[model samples]
Target: MADDKKVLDDGELVLVKDYVEEIITDLKYSTEDNFTLKVIYNYSDAYLRYGTVKKLKKAQEIFKKKGYRIKIWDAYRTVEAQRFMWEIYPDDDFVADPNIGFSNHNRGTAVDVTLVDEAGNELKMPTGFDDFEAVMNYDPEDEKNKERTENASMLNEIMTSCGFRRSTTEWWHFNDTDKYPVVEGFNSII
Candidate 1:
């Protein structure tokens, strides 16, 4: 039990565990609708929970004061749900490659989010989060896709500046310092 880290309880569709306070501050976080699905999709038996709710609230307060807000693309996706995504986009590099050993979602310490205006309007990203294309991942020099590239770059800068790292593939995805040891069986959190 680290003083700054805490296990997340499944109270909502998303499963986000709290991390070190500095880690939370550095992550520039948000939870989107899909992020919620990430948490409980595999373990339907487990209750829903969103780990970053508190951090998000705090971050939102600051962003809102600046006339900006957060938007989400996906949240707490279960390993099973990720598998489904792998099946649907087998060749898609934007998401985790199933052949890869693990994913942040499986560890319950990651989230997908973007920025929005005070009105809650999301700015565009390099590509739609789930879009199955190299261009959607993080190709910064694709002159043909300037809009998406710029969007992805901006989002990545914000998230990374806060201490989150960007996946070479998906710009909206990020991980927290607190990583789960193993994928727990879906249990009733709520």
Candidate 2:
């Protein structure tokens, strides 16, 4: 890792809210609402690499000007959490297999996010967070899914323009192009 890079294990991870207050956070791992059906994180605040947070802040500013707001679902997952998630859903498509390697999220370089209207209602997207079935069923070309496709596309474009790469499988997931080492033995709680 670069000398200036921040990692969760080193206690240098940054809170997303501290840099981008305009971005709303609803960490699914911190609640039972996730596919895991369990609370995986003890902290409610979202944490990410400082550089990744800067990219997110840029995206949030663009969303704000477009009459939308950014809502983050997950960020900066610990290696232990990655292992737990893999045990529950071993599918490599959505959840990264800890045995092979950790996810970009485990390195604080990936984030799952969505767009919300001014009223805080989520915009119509192809699928909700962590819904692999919905992703498979979605057809971006179908007229029935036009609005959803458009919203998802817009989110992808803005995020990519701000230095994040969209996941080919998960619409809400984005990874920072800059690489970072996986954070091991880091407590998720603030």
Candidate 3:
């Protein structure tokens, strides 16, 4: 571990499902469904900084009232996992370069999420998760992408309103405004 990095204990990180039961979690990195096409995580639970989880819980409450739910795709990635993803994608826009610095997800203060309907079906967005072509800030005036833009906009609005900063490149990625040091030694396993 670098001198600048901190090792967060389990107390500082909480399982997303434990914090917000209604929010669905599909940890894509735990399976071969992600861009890496390999399981990057040994466990499947999504974890985030406790403060970040609180914001997500608030977002989930708001979504519940609006007949939608949050589905988390990724959270709290280890530096090893980050390196593996970088090797596969090698795109700084999508995957953070561990050599330069760790990602917010490595700090447990960022998450990849999408909005799902009451039936747990994901809403139509500009593109699927980890799709590099997906732009977070799409042209709302473009009629061809009206529904996709609207859905992405709604998700962005709610997530940002709950104290998360939206990623300009990825529609599904959000970072907590409250900063936390890059964490080390934590894995997806319980």
What lDDT would candidate 1 get against the real structure? 0.51
Ranking by TM-score: 2, 3, 1
> Candidate 2, after superposition: displacement of residue 164 in Å?
0.5
Pairs in clash, predicted candidate 2: none
Overlapping backbone residue pairs in candidate 3 total: 0
Residue 131, candidate 1: C-alpha displacement in angstroms: 1.6
Q: Estimate each model's TM-score.
A: 0.60, 0.92, 0.89
**Runs in model 3 lying further than 4 Å from the true structure:** 1-11, 134-140, 187-190
Residues 35-121, model 1: lDDT tens digits: 223332433221113444444445555566667665644445556666765765566455566466556765655666677775656
Computed on alpha carbons, the lDDT of every model, listed in order, comes to: 0.51, 0.88, 0.86
lDDT of 2 by residue, 18-121 (tens): 77889899999999999989998788888898889888988999999999999999998878788899999999999999899889999888999999999999
Residue 178 deviation, candidate 3, in Å?
A: 0.6
The order by descending lDDT is 2, 3, 1
What CA root-mean-square deviation does each model show from the true structure? 7.5, 4.1, 5.8
| TM-score between candidate 3 and the true structure | 0.89
